[model samples]
Target: MRPGAIVIASSLLVCGAIIGCERDDMWEQPKTAVLGTNEFFDNDQGARMPVKGTVARGADNLQEDDLLYRGMENGKLAERFPFEITENDLNAGHDKYDAFCSPCHAKSGDGMGMIVQRGYKQPFSFHIDRLRNATPGYFYSVLIRGLRPTQLPGVKFEPDDDKVHPAVAHKLSPVERWQIIAYIRALQLSQNATIEDVPMEQRGELDKPKTEGSNGESH
Candidate 1:
């Protein structure tokens, strides 16, 4: 072959190999993308523990607030809430609570949730004297740190179980954990609510009782 032709052919072969290395999806390419199996590390999976000093993406706001994320101040339970409880925060908390807590703690935090009716062990009522007096950090700690094994007696719990909230609760962001704590406090107060606790404009509504018909319908 001519020298010029040989050089051109060799260049083409090299380019083809280089392009094939990137385009050969059938060979050595991960079945999944970033979340797929990764052979580069000892773990053959993409999901691995973060390295030292690895902070969660976009977690700077939460990470910096020790009380918010850790539910502690100087290694002790915070005496008060880490942030102000606005109406918006309370509303968001209601949704989170209903989705995660009501199944076990009930809408009223009375611990008589549907799952409990279906044979799951009953948890302590949030309105209990001890919990009513408990600090806000106490509930937040439960979500982040989980219940003590001794405190979980009578319940057969597995972290993998969907019915249980502890594992799922930990997955919640720091703000979300605190929101739930606020909602629980609100739920506790609701049980012992007095007419005076109702707004003055709404107080008249409390004076009237609903009349029930023979068919168990409210008239």
Candidate 2:
């Protein structure tokens, strides 16, 4: 064959090999599809069962404290906090409450937060008989799982489980959720408190004439 013709034939062979390499057959090579039937395993499930006693990521220490992680004791809602609460914890709770809860539940826990004023559904007042008597675990459950639309049929907020507040689910940690609950209790007490509820030292502050201005100057 002519030299020029031989060169053209060699280039065509190279091009054909390159084109074959780029075909989808490389990616479609033998492999089981997820959930696809596989006779190799006894159960015939392509997806093998996870190894026994395997713990999921970020869940290794979950079993350490049931009350702390799940807000439950003996399979029932916890009646009290899992850890001791200090003044600093309450302060932290106040900050978290104002940042997250105050939008819907209001800083005073009156269910009249700014969002409600702007047309969002008003939440139940924390001072109400039902909520005032609710256990701390109940609040913790709400923070973690949120109110499903069908969870509380006749409840005030009619919380949609799917529409869980992002801040509560993703931002606030478990300890932070407890702190917010403590702050909530404080708000409830403040709203329902009476003269007798005040300490003798603090009672004098309440009796002082209500200040008229931000500067605390008498009008």
Candidate 3:
């Protein structure tokens, strides 16, 4: 009676241990992730709501450079560019302006661009009296907050119902907007600059008399 009862008790104890070792479903169960929803949280949201002063990464830092990003200071259009202009900036500006602005404003800023030639609306010329008097921030504002067809007060705009005209900065960065402005300012100066506007070293060349070249060309 003692040996048989002892063996039966040992077998029952081994079976109980095996039952306790069975896997839990939690390892494979689906659960809500961050920013998701679940019934477990008091508010039924997975992630905790951001605190009152919280901001997106780097946004606060960008806010500090509002002159560069918003193109404004003291609620006015910035009087100057955020950084000093460089030759490299001009080159970048030329490329970006040609790639973006030249389609509607033309390489000459004359408003008769290829797009206009192809039946798009004619934009106001950069050389126009009002535009010529505009500041760098004015052009920056244009890129950031596109010129709506409605914004053109005296100009007749025939809108294309098939097209969606988003603001220029919808795809452009703040830096690119600045670069485009640089190219536009260059274009404006080219049309209105005087002889004194020439660089000191280049000014002397303007006074030199022209000579007849061998092939009826003026040099």
Best candidate, TM-score:
1
TM-score of structure candidate 1: 0.64
Q: Mind giving the per-residue lDDT tens digits that candidate 1 earns over 1-219?
A: 999999999999999998877756677665557678777778687778778987679663446677877777887777688889998888888888888888878887888999999988778788768678878876776787677655545434455534333555545877888888888888889987887799999888767776555342111
Best lDDT among the predictions, by candidate number: 2
Model 1: residues with Cα > 4 Å off, grouped in runs: 1-31, 34-44, 49-64, 149-169, 207-219
lDDT of each: 0.76, 0.79, 0.75
**What TM-score would you give candidate 3 relative to the actual structure?**
0.58
Backbone clash pairs for candidate 2 read: none
> Which wins on TM-score, candidate 1 or candidate 2?
1
Query: Candidate 3 residues 18-78, lDDT tens each?
Result: 8887565865366776677887868898777667888667552457787898787787777
The candidate, 2 or 3, that scores higher on lDDT is: 2
Regions more than 4 Å wrong, model 2 = 1-56, 152-167, 209-219
TM per candidate comes to 0.64, 0.63, 0.58
Residue pair clashes in candidate 1:
none
